[model samples]
Target: MLHIEDLSYETGGRTLVDAVTLHAAPGETVGLVGPNGSGKTTLLRCVYGTLKPSAGQVRVDGTVLDGAKERARRIATVPQDGQSAFELTVREVVAMGRSPHKKFWEPDSAADRLLVDEALARVGVTDLAERPFPGLSGGERQRALVARALVQQPRLLVLDEPTNHLDIRYQLEILTLVRELGTTNLLALHDLNLAAYFCDRIHVLRTGAVVASGTPAEVLTPDLLAEVYGVRAEVAVHPATGAPTVTYLPGPRTPHATTAPASRPSAEQKTSAM
Candidate 1:
């Protein structure tokens, strides 16, 4: 389980995440949906320990997580724009996920290698395992990163824009893989339709605050999209999957950018777990 209590982030006198509180239960998939600069990335960075929150705490299984090594053991993150700066091979990159479990100088065990190989295959990046990290296409790199996160065996998985660089097919496949992992998942997604279909609950953020949160059917109305995104859109329930589906309408852009009041955190605010 993952719990973020009254989380807030500030930099240069600007608040990016403002008093956000949310939780994911043992095996739920929770999504953050918002326009650009709405603090989705900032919030995720705080959760993964990349950027410390100016206030509030991040907890796993009811205990606050502290220290990079300890956080790595429990939370695995596939960042929004994950790219390797080093000239490592794909296998080496994925193998790094095992570092939290090993001593400083320990070599990869056979079991560790097996896990890496399996994760690579699962993400369909086995063919690129020998390739240099910087040489792969964006989609390939994204798959490799997911493979790395999988090998970590984390209790919580935080993904920001997990489908950003993928085509339609791989997008579905990757999200399906995430769901099947059955871990607590906290993801920030730009694609509302994808969020509606895959996420068990969705939190709508605007201007660094959660304006609304609920199951897709309850929160993804045309009015909400118009207010938060400044665009006209049509939302409906999908007959097959019973999920809310969004069909954006082409219209003159509106300046209706006022955000709704932030949703009050409740005891039952649902969050996904891994």
Candidate 2:
């Protein structure tokens, strides 16, 4: 399991993330949802070891992350924007994930190649394996990146906005693929409906803290939506799937007078309005 205890991050005397704690167990998928600037990405960064927490510990399998390189190897991350500077083919990019398993200056072996191919196939990007990395579309590139992470064979996979630039089909495709992998996953997502449908549990962050953590049915109430997002919405179960569905309503509108000119007849006003 991946465990975070009292995690916090500060920069320039301002706290970006407060004392927060969360966890993801093996074979579980946890979704993180919040409004913009709520420190969802920051908390994920801490999980992937990209950023150090100012006042907490990130532990994997009972080992503190700071002192555990092996534990770090068990964690893999896919960030929001999938950009790479290497002028390599998709196969080469996916093959790179095996570096964590190799010794310094070691060359890629046959086992590594097989794993890379498997990972590419797993993400449904095997057909584009020979294409140049920079030539792929946003959705294809995202899949390639995920394939790279899969090649690492991590116990915990952390993704930040994995579906940010994708279409609806790709969004479902990616999350479904992740779910099928059956690895421990922690994903930061903006689409509430997707979270409600795909996540086994969810952590709702608001202003650098986790305000709620539970199953979708327990946490995604209309009151929580209004309190956290400042929007009025109707929450109901999907007719067929029985999953939670949220329908947003427009905010209160200003009252306007419907006064007609003296020259214009009242009948004209009634007909024109209709």
Candidate 3:
């Protein structure tokens, strides 16, 4: 449903994204996994039309994405940054998602309001509908933005760290909700464990390049983790769901062999010496 071909972006003589190519099939959730400053967000920005690519093209359903309105109608993005500029009711904020489906200054129809309410409810933010946006907590703001993205009803959904500031429960909830929507989803996630659990396929990015791409069981290995992230780790499957889990190993490594004590002192001898 979405295609990014040799997408590269650079500024000030430094490449933020370099020749990255990826796609999200219809009804599939593909994850972009990388550490901070690895060009995940910049690549996503190029895909979402926030920034133009220096040497490639972004296509939706076979046609190149060229403008804002058509792109909005086809792709919905929940950015990593969620700071609101103006004070607006939560409902109003979500209602803005409907603008693409309407003409200029055309009032929202009953269907739009219904979709907004349903989206808010789905994201578990219905009670905050009447509240002011700026007053919301960080997690609440993320949920609010997710609600807006849902209401947008685009064919492709792109999220840059959708779980930012969310608690563990909401982190799972937001990704699960996106999965249930069954749309073509491309999201940048920092948590490899979460990526393993939720994404059908994962793409690992290092610096500005794609280092690996495959299913969790295929891509996530101790060696790859060490190579890409410089972390000593072990990968195991969850007992319940069979998803991969990462266990990081910190501190210095244990010696392969250790010397044994020459002789053990008896408790009575130690007591007498003391």
Candidate 4:
């Protein structure tokens, strides 16, 4: 349901995202897995309308994605961090997702409230519904943001590190919840294991370009891991879930081969990409 073609984002003579192209079919969870500064977040921002691409196009459900209002109705994004200029209750924050479907001066309807409550419950943030958004813990804030995206009833969900501050339990819960949602999901994830388990297809990025793209089994090989992440890892299929499982190995690489140098972006670059 989401298609990005030859996407590129450049800033200050540096190319953060370079000629990247990928897609997420309806009800499929497509993952972008890469190390920091590899342009995963930059590509996501370009797709979700947070950043305009220097080149390429983003299309949703066969049509080109344009305009903020229409984009909000079709695509909902859960950024790595949530922010607000003014204090808003959790419920109120989620209720804002429905604004795209309403007139500028229109108030929330009874149906909108129900959707907000349902979304809150779905993300397990019902109790925080009355709390201030900024006062909550990072994980709580992340879940609340997901609830807000859910309330939007978006056709495609773009989540950039949705599990960033979440614990193991919440990590599993959030990814599981997203998997079960059955929406077209485009996720930028740091956890290769989680991406292998949850995503139908995986795309690996390196130095602002797509280095590899395929199913988890095809992309998560030990050689690819070492080449992209500069880490030694053992990849195998799980017996229970039938998904690829990654077991990272410690120690340096062999003397004959040198590990790939990771591209490290600054904090400001990361924030702007997000």
Candidate 5:
């Protein structure tokens, strides 16, 4: 479980995130959704310990997460851009996730290798186990990075756009795998449909603040979508599955009346009918 309390961050006299507070319970998948420049990435960086917040705290299981080694052991992150300095094999890359649990000079043990293999299989990339990370495609590379995070055996998984370059199949595969693992997950996702289908809850961000947070059914309303995303949509329940579905409607071609409907007297309607 993870808890973020009143988190705030600023840079160059502009706030990147403002007093945002949320939590992810164990076995829950929470999606962070918003348009570009909505501070989703900045908030995720703060959660993953890459960027410290100017105020407030990130906690793992009631313990503050600032420079805490134990907290690091419980939290794992897969960033949007998968960067590697060395030409390590996929298996080797995944084995690095175990570093938090090992001593500085400790070598990979048999158990570590098993974990790496399991992680690869879980992410459906076991065949790429022997491949060099640098030689893989973007989607493959992302899966390998996710495998690395999975091998960490984290209590909480934080992903920043894990599906950034992935195709539809792999996107579902990755998110489904995460859901099956039942770890608390806080994911920043750009795909609203994917978020609606996969996430148990969603947090909508706008201009560095949490504008809405609730179940996908509750947060993905037409009004919220129109206001935050500037798109008018028809929100309805899926006929087959009963999930919320959003369909966009074209905006008015010309300026339309912005007033409420006018009230009419019953007598006026009767006289007109006569």
Candidate 6:
């Protein structure tokens, strides 16, 4: 389980994550969603231990995260943007996740290599294992990064924009795999439909604070969508899966712009104007 208690991160007197509290039950897939610059990435960074929270505490399975190595053992994170200048091969990158389990300067054992290979195959990147990380396409890189995280086999997985470069097919495939991993997952996703499809629960963030959190059907109402995202959207149920489906229209309101109508005018309005 992952638990965040009143977590906040501030710098230069500006708060990026504001007193956010949430939890993911064991083996649950929880999603974090917000518009661009809503502090979703910043909040994930705090959980990943790269950026320490200015206030509040983060605990995974009752263990308080204090340092890099300890946190690495408990949480495996696929960052929004990975450092691509390492000049490492895909297999090498995935192998690096095992570092936390090994002593300094120790070489990987046979079992470690087997786990890496399994992770590569699991994410459908086994063919790219020998290829250089920088040479692969964006979607390929994302899968490779996921493979790395899986090999770590942490109690919790933290991913930011995991489907950023994936095609529709891979997006569904990877998310399905994540759900079946039997581990706690906290991901930041831009695709509302994917979040609704995969996450057991979702926490919506706006302006560095959590505006709502609940099951997809419970929290993804049209009113909340309009208020938090400033977009005209509808929440409906999927026919096959019976899950929430979100449809976003073009019209939206901005703080500086007037609110768009909930629904567009009918043909009669245009004919009368003409």
Q: State each model's CA lDDT, in order.
A: 0.86, 0.81, 0.85, 0.86, 0.83, 0.86
Model 3 TM-score (2 dp): 0.91
In model 4, which runs have C-alpha deviations exceeding 4 angstroms? 254-274
In the range 1-274, model 1's lDDT, one tens digit per residue, is 8889999999999999999998899888999999999999999999999898999998999998778999999999998767778999999999999999999979999999999999999999998999999999888889999999999999999999999889999998899899889899999999998888788788988878889988877788778888898887776555555566777778775433323223322213322211
Error of 1 at 46 (Å): 0.2
What RMSD does each model have against the real structure?
5.4, 12.1, 12.2, 8.0, 10.6, 8.7
* TM-score for each model: 0.92, 0.88, 0.91, 0.91, 0.89, 0.90
Over 4 Å off in model 6, which ranges? 252-274
Model 1, backbone clash pairs (residues 3+ apart or across chains), number: 11
Q: After superposition, how far is residue 162 of candidate 5 from its true place, in Å?
A: 1.3
* Alpha carbon RMSD to native, model 3: 12.2
RMSD of 1: 5.4
Report the error of model 3 at residue 110, Å: 0.7
User: Per-residue lDDT tens digits of candidate 3, residues 1-274?
Assistant: 8888898999999998989998888998999998778999999998888898899899999999767999999999999867777989999999999988899999999899999999999999999999999999999989999999999999999999999999999998899889879789999999988888788789999889999998877788777877788777777765545567777789543322212222223324423432
> Could you give candidate 2's per-residue lDDT for residues 1-274 as a string of tens digits?
8788999999899888899898888788899999999999999998888788899988878777553357447888888877777778999988878877788779998889899988898888989999999888888888898999999888889999899778888788888778778789999999998887777788999999999998777777777887888887777766544556767778753222222111211323322322
lDDT of 6 by residue, 136-160 (tens): 8889999999999999989999999
Q: How close is candidate 2 to the true structure, as a TM-score?
A: 0.88
Give the runs in model 2 whose Cα sits over 4 Å from its true position.
Answer: 67-72, 253-274
Per-candidate total of colliding backbone pairs: 11, 0, 0, 0, 0, 0
* lDDT for each residue of candidate 5 in 1-274, tens digit (9 for 90 to 100): 7899999999999999999999988888899999999999999999988888999999888988656467569998998978787889888888989999999979999999889888899888999988888888889989999999988889999999999889988997888788778799999998887787678789999999999998777787767877888877766655443445666778843222222212212323322322
Better by TM-score, candidate 4 or 2: 4
